[model samples]
Target: MSYFFQIVVSGMVVGSIYALAALGLVLVYKSSRVANFAHGQIIAAGAFITFYLTTTVGIPIFFSFLASMVITFFLAMSVERIFLRRLIGEPIISVIMVTIGLASIIDGLIYLTPFGTENFSFPPFLPQDPLSLGGVSISWTQLVGMIITFIMIGGFSWFFKKSTVGISMRAVSDDQFGSMSVGISVPRVFGLAWATAGLSAAAAGCIIGNITGLNFDTLHAFGIVVFPVVILGGLDSILGAVVAGIIMGLIQQFASGYLDGNWGLNGTGDVMPYVILLIILLFKPHGLFGIHEIERV
Candidate 1:
């Protein structure tokens, strides 16, 4: 029972990170309808920047985290301007392929940096001691990560619900032509969406780095995994993203905790989500929270 509780605690920690990561993907998809394959690279860049600032440049970790968020904001915006802006109104397949290409390009660029290959940890600022409750232990790093994630998620929820810019984004998502007729600059909204997504990606990266240590490979892989999260939650719903992310995280933890080494399953955690995703796609194509459009057959 204690062991089961331990897995649940860890699952929440990991699920929170997934929720943060999926938030960015949902932000971009909500406004632009563009699935960003380059998201992982942006995440990797954010993690590396934080690592560089804290370790090499001698800045504090907190400041480095904010700086990385700012940097990726512009980095993602410029990427939008250069690569995606021209491809506006292009076929969806073309746009997706372009983002995939951009992801590859960023991966190649990161590979040139020493940080890409090396493993680095944040400076020891948190207590090494673990907090315990009835035989379940949680570390400070994970606790902090979860706190930051919830704060950010709450902030984003408020943004989408109350902010002017966020409402404008929702308008565009609902009907681009209708929004444009009302004088909303659709392109600008798209850019802003990408920018916000980038910012969230950076925050997620920093938190993950602090908890798991800085590793380019590990940080970027979240990009791919976020697809299942977004799909399960409904691609355009922020609430869906959060709920789905937690669900996926818990599912992953439970699988790895109980299913591994039973009947020769090596890595159930890594593969099960994708399998579930495919099953979801086949049946619940609109996802749990996705808006349903009825087409008369």
Candidate 2:
């Protein structure tokens, strides 16, 4: 019983991270209708920057985290301004290929640094004790990471609902021509959307770094996992992303705990989520929360 609850708790933690990761994809897709293949590299970049700032630059961990977010915020925006800005209104496949190119370029650049070949973990700043509740335990790093992720999620939710720039983004997403007729700069909105997604990616990177240690390969693979999250949650729905993230997280954790050891299954945890994704998608092609966009003949 305790073991079951413990798995549940672990799933929530992972789910929240997945939710955070999916935000980047959702934001980018909402504006440009292009998927970013380079997002995992951005995540890795932010984590390495945080680690560098904390260890070598002598900044506090919290401050380092903020600094990394701001830095990546600009880094991502530059990628858009320099490489992608001109590609606006081009074929969707062209834009997607550009993102893949950016991913490979970033991969090459990171390889030149120590973070590319070496594995590093953040120096522990929190107390090294796991908080136990009813025979279930969670560490301080996990608790803090979860709190930060939730706070960011709430902040983004509020931004989309209330802020002016956020509203502009929403308008552009709905209809770029309509937004432009109303004097909104569609290009600027697109740039801001990418920047905002970058911010979210940085935050997710820092959280994962704190929880799992900074491994280039591990952080790099996270982008691939986010596709299912976006698909499960509906690419255009923020609320759906949040719910889907938690669902997938819980599913993976529960499968790992319950089905791994007793049966002949060895990697059920890794395989089940995709299986479920295929099954659910067969039923709801637009995803659990995706809008049913209709085209009139």
Candidate 3:
């Protein structure tokens, strides 16, 4: 029973991070209707930047974390402005290909840096002890990371629902032409969406780096992993992302705990998400929270 609860705790921690990371994909799709293949690179870059700032620049981890998010925010905006901006009116497939190309370009660029192949871990600032509750133990790093993740989630939820810029973003997402008619800059909203996604990606990166030592490949894989999460949660629904993230996390954790231990199922945790994704695609193609558009042809 204790072990079960422990797995639940672990699942929630991982799920919260997934929710935050998935938000990046959601935001980009909501605004520009383009998927960001370069998102993983951005996540890795943010972790590396934070690591560099903390270890080399002698800044505190907390401050470095903020600095990385801010830096990535503008960097993402610049990417949108310089590359994606030109391809705005292009076909969706073309834009997606550009993103894949951008991902490769960023991959090559990161390979040039020391962080590309090397592994790094953030310096420990939190206490070494784990918090134990009813025989379930969670480390300080995990707890703090989980708290930070939820706080950002809550803040973004508020921003998305109540803020003027957020409202404008939603308006643009729904109808770019209609938003333009009302004085909203569609391009600008697209830039803002990317920037905000970058911000969340950075935060996710820092938390992940703190919890799991940073390796370029391991960190970047998060981009691929969150795809199932966002897909399961409906690409356009923020609430769906959160709920789906938690669900996926729990499923993975439970599979690892029960299936692997009892049935000799190996790698079930990693594979379960894709299985669920296939199921969702077959049965709930729009995802649990995705809006179904009925076109009148």
The TM-scores of all predictions, comma-separated, are 0.97, 0.97, 0.98
**What TM-score quantifies how close candidate 2 is to the native fold?**
0.97
lDDT of 2: 0.91
- Candidate 1 lDDT over 1-297, as tens digits, reads 999999999989988999999999999889988999999889888888888888899998899899999999998888888899898889999999999999999999998988779888888888999998899999998999999999999999999999999999999999999999999999999889999999999999988888888888888899999899999999999899999989999999999999999998879999888988999999999888999877798
- lDDT preference between candidates 1 and 3, better one: 3
Candidate that beats the other on TM-score, 2 or 3, i.e. the better one: 3
* CA lDDT, candidate 2, residue 59: 99
lDDT (Cα) of model 1: 0.91
Best by lDDT: 3
Return the TM-score for candidate 1, rounded to 2 decimals: 0.97
Candidate 1 ranges with C-alpha deviation above 4 Å: 294-297
Q: Any idea how many clashes model 1 has?
A: 0
| Candidate lDDT (C-alpha), each | 0.91, 0.91, 0.92
> Compared with the true structure, what per-residue lDDT tens digits does model 2 show for residues 14-69?
99999999999999998878789899999999999999999999899899999999
Task: List all candidate RMSDs to the true structure.
Answer: 1.3, 1.1, 1.0
